[model samples]
Target: MFHLKKINKEKSDYYFMSGFTWLMGYLMIKCEQQKYRMMKIQKLYLFNLLCCLSTCTGLRGLISLEHKVYILEPMEEGNTHRLYRGEHLKLTQGTCGHGHNISYPTQMTNTTGHKRDAQSSTKHVELIIVADNREYQKQGKDVEKVKQRLAEIANYVDKFYRSLNIRVALVGLEVWSDGDKCSITQDPFTSLHEFLDWRKLKLLPQRPHDNAQLISGVYFQGTTIGMAPIMSMCTAEQSGGIVMDHSDNPLGAAVTLAHELGHNFGMNHDTPERGCGCRATVDRGGCIMTPSTGYPFPTVFSTCSKKDLAASLEKGVGMCLFNMPEVKVLYGGQKCGNGYVEEGEQCDCGDVEECLNPCCNASTCTLKQEAVCAHGQCCEDCQLKPAGTPCRESSNSCDLPEFCTGADPHCPANVYLHDGNACQGVDGHCYNGICQTHEQQCITLWGQGAKPAPGICFERVNSAGDPYGNCGKDAKGSFAKCEARDAKCGKMQCQGGANRPVIGTNAVSIETNIPLQEGGRILCRGTHVYLGDDMPDPGLVLTGTKCGENMMCINRQCQNISVLGVHDCSAKCSGHGVCNNNMNCHCESLWAPPFCDKAGFGGSMDSGPMRPTDSSGVTVGILVAFLCLLGVGIIVCFKRKTLLSLFFSNKNSTIEKLRKTLRIFFFCKSKKIKPILRPFIFFDIETMIKHDDN
Candidate 1:
């Protein structure tokens, strides 16, 4: 949809119309059953229109979700510190680490059944970036652009999984080797076999479900830095395993594949401690897999890390629980172990609780019935404390009388007036059960303590007075608002500014509202040399990021590029060159210029054009110039006569005769109608009828 804004009578009034001629064409391919697809397109258009609308309306609040991946040469994709977002991407783009995420505006419509299916089957792999691309190269595809290609794959993958009810996984295929031996062209079997070996797969760890499907795969086919800029191949779903060149660092390929493979199994980040390499803590940031930035820290697992891993694995790849050898060993092939079936161990319900346990998680306990009283005293007395009384013994409040076991009273064992078995101080907090000081909170968008700023949380909003970041709600991730008190690398400062490009040097790829290709190279302060369609009529070179979805392409340019005229002549002509949406254009009459640029010429010569002829053949065909001049007296009498003063010339007399014949015939009837009558003087109509030869 394209929109026009008018400051109507002092207030703004905006009008929206379909800007894309192609949209009309697309709509014609109508499949009523495919409402989801239509809705998505509509949403995308509306979203685009809204951006313009907001700018015109002066509305401040707007939200945008951008999916971007960086195809890093030496490193693996998306860096682990970038934790799995846990939000399913609607689309993906490009490959390797560098690709845009795909979210088609078209897939917004969902029938109830379709929605259910999507929910049941497609769970989000927060860590695995999914980008989309939608083009088939006329020339061979440029597979070297790992990021570009991956984005395309993401789109397809997202659409495929949207309506599926089965659990889907992204598979990463990077090669690896063993024991001080590393050659590239990473082998999946050699590298990945160790991480998720059949042995590990067979140990049933958690709840089991049977919905599973492969969403995507990643492999390496391109360059790896120093060799060439074209360095990788990535699937939109981040599942494409790595296929490294022998010269490439095989370990990097392996890890990359491991990252994507983990996504398939519902792993958000590679390391579970929220950060990587042993600085294990709930809040300490590490690898993206662990919710932290610092990885390569030495130990991969810690007491706190193991527990988190057990839980995540159990939840995401619950099907793996049945992959345990015990389940398989006893029951044909079940991964989960225990006792109760025809196997060595049964009661899987119990072992499942333990296998999934790690330092981060509390261990599950078995249930048993016991006497209410002991030794004639209240058996409950053996339990120590009563259930209702609060225990002030510990700050955790776990020692509350209700849970008091005289044998052991620890922090969390008691209760408090708050959640997380703890409370926040004047400037402290246990956000989502994690503790942080007031200074930390102040640095956060939410900040800490009482109103840091007024009508806001921490500071005044940028440009627009919108409530900045998180006041009571969450603020935008990956960006923070700025503060005056901050300096380079100081507190409360926006990281890289809110508008920096996500990958590399914060330089954004341009999106044009110009007459050009969607994904082509465009340079600032210069016009793109079009390969084919380049019209010379000068117009502003579009210099921006992406044309709005609602805009249409006209003569290789965007349709909204028009004068402030009342109607969109070009836009209307976009469908049919003659008529515009406002209903005006003379297509048949238009000649040299654009058909819609001006009104058509009209005349009252109702079905009329008099034929004219020359009689030069009879007057001057055989005569010399002098002779022809001598015949000027006759020429003057007859405008139809012709004479060539320089050279004798002739005109066909037959044409002249034909013209005269037509002229007389048409002139008689046209000037005035004359009724035709028979020569009745001889006989009246009645007499003639009576006298007719019978």
Candidate 2:
């Protein structure tokens, strides 16, 4: 009876287990099907949204959406999949004047003024981004959301600049939760000026960076969406720009910001006259520097932009971009394969697929075995270069060279001549690592054979406060007259060049005849470019121009260069060196720094030695000295016996002479002749002996 009951219980348990297994299997299958349906629904919703954007936004060539949209979701941890779609929007029609629309003459080659091999090297822009109060409010006053949006915009900008061999590293992000730090107005020019001033006086002192950008939610007065000073990158006063947050999507603002930043990099508008080559057609996104951006946002730079960047760099613009940024201060959290050498990382060459460094293991962001370094100009074959190795040469008259420290795997940061220092090969002063002169400016504007007009022309024509002759526009947007003392700092006047302003079709020549007191009249030619109200007048004399001896243009005034204390700084160089922008002495090739009084391999403390230590030469000198000493010792040893015999012979001749002299004296005494006779005889004998000795 017991055995029968046990068997029945076992059978019941087995049946229950089988039923439970079947139920669990059915539920799992149902869940998988539901997941698939959800994924399909999400994809459909995204497709419909894209279609609506394309139709309403007038985005053409978007039918091939698969090729246009890029998904970068799984790359970021905890971040949802983001779909970058639609063509970049047309934010502004303003053009940058940094290049001054100056067209190079066909006969004049090498317009860049210097070689630009440095363009091939990667440049990192340590960027700081700020969001205005309006932007903060537009994002529901959520600081985290604002920060996220700014980061995303920076990512897009980085993507855009990557092709140009430039990296936009976001070092800091700030949100003005309380209010705007500087005044923000509808006038784009005024807002830009105020923001730049604030950046120079306040933000720059607090946090150091290569450049800064302000994103605002307020719409500008006109069609202008962004503005920046052209070719002013890395400057303390104007290395920044302003962009309006015009689109709900961060990509739109990103494109606008990138356009303005390009202006700072000296890139001009890709106008039809330029005939700029662009890979992307107008139906696609076009190029980043297009004057009038439209439906599709431009994500690529044109050939003109690339050429402009190269020219600007060769002219010493963006001097601070060569050095790598401190990865510790990077805004984003640390992660492997981010292309930065962070804490605990031996080296980082980017992600596994993009990394091309043989010295690095991309999967772990670590250096390969026996590899000392994986990056930097000072690192070669995964090893640090010797101290005094030239890593960067001077690009222009005002630029200084950089060298390797030997101990570090990177070169020192770039330095240049101090402001107010006289420029080399140019009749101007160095300011912000550029030698700006009226002659150079005229040549750029009017092609070749252009010279600055006489002083009388500048004095007479610039006195009138009009569009044709003015210092610049005031805060209220009206032209301001030039004071007599500041006349040279006003609108530039030239005498000879091409028939018309060679800059562009939009530029017109303004001629004025000044009757000299001596009775002859001089003609002054000036330029006016229709660059809109957003840009500063390029016709004005650029700052750092030599308005007078020891005087330079500053804020529309002819100020003494003494104010920069360049003389004081140069005095410390001990007449053997020049002062760099950091106010330190850059020594001569045979002198040491900090004073340049001692002899050593030359360079400033900030930059490594200019020449190598010459270890091989030192070794050769030591060997030569040792060989010379050995030769002298051998000669002395071989001649020892001859020297000894000569000494003994001389001693014997002296002894014989003494004995003969004694015998003569005794014979003279014995003869008893006159004492005078004896004295005469002794004297004769003494003369004979002296003659023999001589």
Candidate 3:
């Protein structure tokens, strides 16, 4: 009296329901063979209700439904990595020039420079700053001014790098000049390399270590403004240097210096031409990689820049920054005296008497094998013993004399009475038998009065001569639970939806147990229960709906049409500044207006241009007149001797006055004359003309 009918559904749904009926019957017969008792078939409405809870609220919903239980399984795919930390940075700055002459001293003002808070940085980066400005020293440039300039430059650089865990310190300043002249103007990059080569050979007695990054600046009367070390930042080459011009603007100089060093640190310009994904232009203050640094400077590094820098570091670029004098070994450790081999030792065992092997040398924590001290397995007890050696089983079983024969001689193998032959032991079971046990047959149940099992429909006799058929626990052929023992039968799981089949032992579902959505139907493929419209595209959707935030619904689920936030104000706040949670751009300094546009903004608004006032104008004019009179008096006092000498020589003849002018020209023509005195001679003639005119 089991009646099967097709309900109103789609073509695929109808086929799925038909297959489900067959699958359910097969599972019930398979489970009965395992001696599982027939249980009352649960109503289809109960399983359908469980599906509704599982879909909307996840595992918690399934928990509320006492009949179904599920565990939250972690998906392996979508994991995010944390930022890099604890990298080391070593810094150096060397100022060089032509050997004999002093170059212009670059000014480093500590008071006027930017200083970053490196101590509060999360990344544990160690910084060391060293400098050598010998060329400036030889020419009598002001040492104090040079030191000030270095401090200022360091401050500015530290500010720029503080967020990156880079701290800068001024460690050493020394003069390193040789030869008569060393001008770097002709070819600054080439000149820097030559200077670096010379500097390496002349490292200070206390500075011979190769662990720190060498950053140097060369001062010279070169036509070139500045130059950085070639291949220093892009490759594994560690040492990098810059050529600096003292005459340049301090801000511009610092910026340019930072730019060159950035190159050495594996950063490129923020344009597609430089391999950046985004194009950096005047309008877009996206990054600092562009050639011209304008009014509103870039405040942050671009995503491309950060990614490339990380990639370069991961590729071993700039590792020379970690090479330091304090490091004792390539693989870092402490010496032997600190109660461990970590200080600077290969090994460190406690005492000589405690060493198990006689050859063990306690003083060095090594084995003296044939007069050679060995670190790895040096003692006899540490070495592997050979086979057939007489040994005790273990400390607990020392009384049993055992002969070692296996690969690990410390553990002896079991000896049989006969080799390659089976023998019956005293207990009568075949000992050391190579044969495997016989496979068990499937358990079959007899039909009551040949009416067949409660819900089973006999299909055919299986290959094992068992009457296998579509089976279930109930008379109506609806199963409370079903299980299939065959490998082809695999496993059954309960699935509830509009048109889906529920398969399992009726007791519990194993392997995977995902409940179906409210209106969603399920399809069984092997042991998997696929739910919803996603069953058609198993590859498209992983678990939930396959639609994105910016998608359109074609049928029931979403499909991608266009993406959001690509060119909107959200993309880095339109490149003006960092975007906050409220979706507004908080602009950086030198930037104004809403979008952070660079055209209208120049400098800070608070420090605008000043206009002349009536009172200030009168005061400025009076001060200028007073200064002019004082300058004339001082000129007459200092040039009296020259004026008197000229007056006596010109007093005799009319031709003497003309000869006096020619005499001045002859004085300038002489190379022996110092250039410093030329300005005074011109000033004296101008004063005499003014006096005669008056």
Candidate 4:
């Protein structure tokens, strides 16, 4: 009941060969079904054998010609961006008091994903800072001083966030003053929470897709600063907003804002109870999350706090701070081939030419000397050669045999013998790889001994390798070795040596060399350090009020000094177009330049999907043909037994044999192959069988 299955034309490039085998098998089966069993069976077996041979030959041809290589296409614009969780991280800020609104310097701007800061990480955080006009007017603070203070605080916070690689931008700024007695006294902290819920103000758009965060700031000049809730309502909370007392100490205010934002990002207070506490004092320096502000300002966060922050950001709890559109950070993982030698990379030869290391393989990013060469010869080929293999030192050098001794055999760089090596060229001694006199060897090792000492010459030694003979004793004496542990120590690294002090522990003493001091001891626990009784207030050490006119204060460091003049269009574009350094307006397609004052129906035209070139088309066609041939072979195998039986049946007369022969010939000819005389030979056999039966 078996029947020939349909072949896939696209993959049937060997259809003619498969058809020929099927025909031969059919004829053999027919021969086996005759009354003369012995003779017919022998002929059938012979015919099947021939078919198998032909099939194997045809299969070999198909396999040899069917392979193809796929070329990678260039990446399209915005395609990689789509791989991110979202397009942008939006941070909405609400400020209290109006006279002087805190504005961030252009250096703190976050229009794109990457942040340029000391942290050396990349990412973006959209910022929208607004002032609550009612609270500001009610407080009635000096506008100029308040504005200056707010700017300082804003600038500080911007730097702090940037250190975490979260670019900060003040995208929205407004004054809200139309309410009744919405006084600063009405608990600005809790009131700010309500302000976030006030949908009518609509100062910022509520786009959950943007992964936004809301932070609010309050300032009261004469009012006493007291305990307040700097709440960050995260996944575990119903709402989120930070309320801070921003009167004096801009540095303190910035720290407070960061602390509250940590809460929203799902970080708990890092106090003694939570496993990391300050050794200097029980109340302070455990982290930015310390319940009480023992010091006016703390510049560092504890290890636990940083760990929690990293986790929060990784878990996507801190809205817009991590994994947002255009933001790249450690959480996103490192990408190879950026040309920079980053973590987890052994080598990065942007183009292949940069790789020149002897044992390194640039293309595969691995070592291949062991696999490619024998013990003594250089790795010039991917096959093992025996010891004493002939080699050349260089293109200009005379040929020499390789010295096969180490794990990887290589030719000696110098022609002369080394220590313990047999001398050559009528010399019985050697020193520093050169043939030497008996006195020279004694001078090199024993400093010109009265008599040349026996076996005194030893190989020169170094930290990385053992010497040929006893040379010296260990220098550092006995000391317990501490394993290297990863820890955040500002710009310092904890690499487990005498000078590399361990950080994030209960007690450690490190020598400090900051300006104004010759040298002093810094005793620290977690991120907080102890100040001596005679020492000045810690606030001065952590905060700085001065910076170059063109620079901004970042973590007490002056940075963001532009290499070139900046071109800003805040006065012209009105937010429609970005001004380039050349002072030219780069407007959106829908708006015209010159401040983007005019709107028009203009945008990009959509083109159809990309199509392959003619060469690619040809490649695809070849692949299709190969597939078709494979499909046909599979189909032929499926009905092989049945076709053989039908052809060998006694009822398959001469006329039926002729018909089958004609059909197979026609099929083969249609496939664009020269018709073989095998079908006619089969007809002749059929005729002979018929005559014998008569």
lDDT of 4 by residue, 582-602 (tens): 344434546654556777321
C-alpha lDDT values of all predictions = 0.23, 0.74, 0.30, 0.32
TM-score winner between 2 and 4, please give it.
Answer: 2
| Candidates ranked, most accurate by lDDT first | 2, 4, 3, 1
The candidate 3 region of ten consecutive residues with least summed lDDT is: 435-444
As for lDDT, the candidate ahead, 1 or 2, is: 2
Model 4 spans with C-alpha error above 4 angstroms: 1-123, 138-148, 177-185, 188-190, 199-201, 206-239, 277-286, 294-296, 322-622, 626-694
| lDDT for each residue of candidate 1 in 504-576, tens digit (9 for 90 to 100) | 2212322122222456432111011111111110111111101122222222222332322213543444332
In angstroms, what RMSD does candidate 4 have relative to the true structure? 37.4
Alpha carbon lDDT at 593, candidate 4 = 48
Candidate 1 lDDT at 216 equals 18
TM-score of 2: 0.79
TM-score, per-candidate, Cα-based: 0.20, 0.79, 0.26, 0.30
Best by lDDT: 2
Worst 10 residues of 4 by lDDT: 57-66
Per-residue CA lDDT of candidate 2, range 469-582, in tens?
A: 888877777888999999999999998999998867779999988887889888999999887777777778988888999999998889999999999999999999999999
Evaluated against the true structure, the overall lDDT of model 2 is: 0.74
Model 2 misses residue 456 by how many Å?
A: 1.0
Model 1 alpha-carbon drift over 4 Å, by segment: 1-215, 218-439, 443-694
